[model samples]
Target: MKTKSTTLLLTAITGSLILLLGSGCGKKTVMPPETTMDGGADAGTPISYPAAEGGGYSEESLPIEGSLDDTSTATSVTAAEGMAEPTEEYKKLYGRSTRGLSPIYFNFDQATIRPDMVAKMESNSEYIRQIPNAYVVIEGNTDDRGTNEYNIALAERRAQNTKQYLVDLGTDPARVRTVSYGEEKPLFFGQDEISYSQNRRADFIIE
Candidate 1:
């Protein structure tokens, strides 16, 4: 009887040990990366992943979308690079008129004008034509997305395209110049889609 009792106790202890081991060493689950190895996430939002069931990883609170200045480390371009400095008389007469025009937004990685934005561009052309001898500077900008070099080139294309369209609409090509600020000057500094969309545009800077 004593031998049978001892055997039962040993079995029970062994089962208890196995359960403890199983609970202590649970299987770990790893998540797949959000982007490819080359990192081709131009304007892609960073994913917010939840914690794993049994894995140990502390969550980090990163700053999200906000209406603030969030320009990256990009070199500033000068206005003189495109056009001469505005005269005091020019500023007094047409500064408010030109600066008051609303900026036209562009699509992701596109330099062409959108079908919906054609009317707005036409309005801009009319406004430019109204102000006779108005020195116009189209400042090209981009959202905080691509690399510095890529954004600069993209912005230049935007400014160039806008200038060409204005010229095509009877505006003087000599009077209109373009400067690419890339992602340096942001209208809306949020990291979300809305803010990024606002930032991707060409602004009319009356010189």
Candidate 2:
């Protein structure tokens, strides 16, 4: 009996020791890496996180569509040959007169009719003559070299001069309106003589 009791106690103690060792083995922690590598060498495996939801890249990082700007930066242009033109409406708008007559322009700084410009003005006047009720506005502008008040006066003189010329061609004076822009609206914006010359002219607007 004594021997059997001793054997039973030894078996219980052996099982308990085995259970303790197994529990301790699972509780051991793993070490992490100290540097970046392709794969993790330990339990703290390096995971690749994707770019942030909306803040990772810049517009410059995107693929360019067509020709870039003067700089190597990305710019948008027609990416495909068969793509429809984006400015089709603008081209059409400039193609024809929307109102009763197309506009007529004058020579730079000269309100006196030139022979070539007179022929074009006659054609434009015929448009109003065809539609007697048609009305138009003559807008005169000047270059940026003069004071605003002085330019306004000069522009008014040019506009009235054009209107008088049209009236002399048998168009009714009541059907015309005139406005002066006084160096306000330049056809081109630059400090050069070319731009100034462009702005020093008269244009007709039809309503």
- Model 1 regions more than 4 Å off: 1-97
RMSD of 1: 18.2
Writing each residue's lDDT as its tens digit, candidate 2 over 153-198 gives 8888888888898999998899998898878876567889766655
Q: lDDT for every model?
A: 0.72, 0.66
Counted clashes in each candidate structure: 0, 0
What is the lDDT, from 0 to 100, of the residue 201 in candidate 2? 64
Per-model TM values vs. the true structure: 0.53, 0.51
Q: Write the per-residue lDDT of candidate 1 for residues 57-152, one digit (tens) a residue.
A: 443332223212322312222333532343433332332235556577799999987788678678888887788877898988899898989999
Candidate 1 colliding pairs, count: 0
Best by TM-score: 1
| lDDT leader | 1
